[model samples]
Target: MELTYLRTFREVAKWGSFTKAAETLGYAQSSITTQIQKLEEAYGAVLLERYGRKMVLTMAGEALLQYANYICRLHDESKEVVAKQSKGTLSIGTIETLASFYLPAYLQAYRKAYPDVNVAIQPGNEPFIIDAVKEGALDIGIILDPPFSDPELDCSILREEPLVIIVSPDHPLAGQGEIGVEDLENESLILTEDGCTYRAMLLKVLKSNQVTFKLSYEFGSLEAIKQCVTYGLGIALLPRIAVTEEVMAGKLAAIPFIHPECKFYTQLICAKKKWKSKAYVGFLELLSGGAREGDSDAGSELSK
Candidate 1:
């Protein structure tokens, strides 16, 4: 089987649309179809079945996807290993929240320690960054929270961030110190988009309590949400780090959640089976301080 065919198949499988796969790979739609067709022919099995305009993977396609991912990872790993010996670069992906709040100091230290190593930092939202890492477009990523579960990826907790409620100083619940979920009834709420892990958690809590609030707005950008809150648009539930400056400057008041202080772990995530390089190990050590916890080293010394 041609590796190019497998690559095309993987791209199609990832996007679930031939058009999208073609666009992403810079190939024509017919070329994507022909590649998948050739792959199916070589395997002597149907890989994908079309439903309306979208495509769903057959069992064979699903099985092939696993192998394709492994092959792609191996290919990248080999390239990275060679690059490491020849002055290669490291690609790191991170969400906007971490990029704005925590990554600067860590990156500064990393640069000072390894000035010879080339580093590229890609900043995006959580979902985009996670997808990039999984697809081998990024070597590693730091996200505000981990996904539900992925056997192919290893996730290590970097820190825990408390979720706080932000409101105008004069809002009724602003001076209450800590407020329960029940206290938020009838308040205007601003939230992040649905895919955000913390947003999902907050929605789950609200639904479970049968509480109702006026959802004033939902935003995709963290900065936009902060700006909205600064103008007293509505109360916002946000990671403590995201609102620290605003809260400190008296532009917003942060109150802890009384019932269950919304908290989520920030984590460093990477492909599980990829070969670890000295640079990767060194970076992990710097982050974890040399302790391996739960199959992940907070600091390095653990053998693969």
Candidate 2:
């Protein structure tokens, strides 16, 4: 019946462990167990069951979780409204490339406009970011992916991001004007992690062409992959924006990797039903090529 119990239940279901939930919520293990019992008693249904090493939600728990997410979000929103807080926290989930190469200027502008607002940037893979946005854990998500559509999300196409093949300046393919899938035959490749959007696209293109290639290294860090390519370990396919500085500095070479299937866009996504805070709306404006007054410099930089 208490909101605290519902919050505890959500955490328990999230981690699927009473001890872990207690640790997360700063409660005793017994307290977590008590809360879950109270919930089950209130609902007149068992909410969770042990499945092997982890606790799994029962059918009743699954249904309650859906409503719990909405309830918690609404509760938080109500506090913001009642307090009339001008500065609030903005949570964003995005992939590494956009987080590193793309969002910096916009974030800077957002900070200038809302100096007291706290910003949290969580870097994750595409699917993780998308799901976090839908589940209300993230305020917004920015990703570079092929065209995407979700009925529950409001998606906007920001711009096309060109994918490129990167190599050390001294590598054999460095001077090439453009490269094709066949050019990768018998080549070694340093690539991003498995769930990366562009990584999946690159793999699909090579597999369809039947190009014999070696996976030299797979990394979760974009800088790590770039360093590997810079040292002549292998070539890599990445967003052009990610390697712009090194390429312009003559430390790396970027060749246009042309393929119909290689097209990708930088996108913004938010849950359609979520309430927009002032800070959230301000950041959205920056992303959409507008800026707050007296913040024209940030706007000009982002508009480029």
Scored by lDDT, the top model is 2
Query: Which portions of model 1 miss their true places by more than 4 Å?
Result: 1-86, 146-149, 259-261, 290-304
Write model 1 residue lDDT over 53-103, tens digit each, in one string.
889999999999999999988988878766654356778898667777766
Colliding pairs, model 2: none
Residue range with the least summed lDDT across 10 consecutive positions in model 1: 295-304
Error of 1 at 153 (Å): 1.6
The candidate that wins on TM-score is 2
lDDT of 2 by residue, 90-153 (tens): 9999998988877887877777777888899999999999999999999999988888899999
Stretches > 4 Å off in candidate 2:
1-85, 290-304
